[model samples]
Target: MEHPARTLTARLLASRSLPRTDPQVRRALVDEAFRAELEARLAAVGLQLIDNPYAEHVAVALADDVHEPVFGAGREYAASNIGLTRDQIALLVIIWALIVLPKRERQVNRQKLIDDGQHDMFGQEAPLPHGEEVAGSLSEASLLADFAPVLGHKTYVQGKLLSRLAQLGFIERRGGLIFEGPLLDVLLDYRLLADRIIHGTLGEVLAQAGHPLPDSDGADEGL
Candidate 1:
């Protein structure tokens, strides 16, 4: 919501201001005020704020298709762990979609694996990643564990919800595991990559090459 307003504001900024006679300025002001009010309302609860405008400095490892944040690190963000606002929740969704989900996709598929199913680079020690059903508890998925800190939800709850999302057409799942394809698509469609971008140890190298930040969602940093 806030992003939409700001996007609208940016578009509005592109054109000249006509505050002297144009009534459109009022609408923009009203939108900003509404967002502020909404933020205030959310703050009335226990949710704190963190600026993710550019969601800079990748906090988690991700795939190549995911893009980095443009306004991160320097921008002001509003977030809350307890009483989240619609915008705050939306931002979380956007971050995972844009940043986390894409990176997850790149980590698991394609030519990286050998024809016999061994990893080309890792040669089978690629975490041998699998999900152990996650039926009785939420202890199976590490990605859920990784996300719990940022989203401020119980690991169990987050895993359960992700499982549920996977169950529906919203995403895909198998072997008690959830892949990044469908999930990343949803996040991208939702324009979510504006959250944290977890970089790998080779962050400098990737940044110089203008590539997506390296992350540890798959093997530990290296291929």
Candidate 2:
């Protein structure tokens, strides 16, 4: 008979080498013996190996010692609050740029004129004030351009993504323009959560564009 240690090692090696597409391999991957060993090993490092076959990918997280009630529900509620898919988050960031950048530019110009003591350019003693309404509308063309780097090459996919976001109440499309919806208000209410979600969703884009992400300091960087 093979040595007990050698037998366990062989089983682990065989399980790791198995292809996930094969039924037998899938079963072996989640075998009770293998999971027991995995859990024991993970526990040594204060982690847990949860089996979530329904998830598209595995997730790693810090283990919590507290067993408080309603904790799971609270987590679910937070997820629901920021329920936009990854693609939708990316699209929303682009829309925000289109809506905010122009207003920011105008505000800078108005401040400059006021500093120069030339505030009567429009026959008024004060400069025209910038308002939120002016920065909340975006044309379809601009949005398409903003989305080009990520989703532009695939027009069908882009259209579907935009339609999905609209259907989810994240954006409103009217004529050839898009406007912020109630969902955006919810995101803004939780600014930190929104930032973290955007950071994770746009990580690849930021890397490709040679942009740096803000430093993480005990913030949720998405799942």
> For residues 52-162, what per-residue lDDT tens digits would candidate 1 score against the true structure?
111111111122222224224532433522333543454334334333434444434432453346645555543322222211112225444544555457654445555
Name the regions of candidate 1 deviating beyond 4 angstroms.
1-140, 149-160, 181-183, 186-212, 215-223
Q: Per-residue alpha-carbon lDDT of model 2 for 1-223, expressed as tens digits?
A: 7543234334433432222344433443457775566556545545443322211112222245431232454565343334656666667665544443343344445555665678655433443343452345767765566455566454743577778777765567898888765344333322343355345655445445543344333222112
lDDT of 1 at 156: 44
lDDT of all predictions, in order shown?
Answer: 0.36, 0.47
| Residue 73, candidate 1: C-alpha displacement in angstroms | 33
Model 2: residues with Cα > 4 Å off, grouped in runs = 1-82, 111-117, 120-128, 131-142, 145-160, 167-170, 179-223
Residue pair clashes in candidate 2: none
Ten contiguous residues minimizing lDDT sum, candidate 2 = 52-61
- After TM-score superposition, the amount by which residue 139's alpha carbon in candidate 2 deviates from its true location, in angstroms, is 4.2
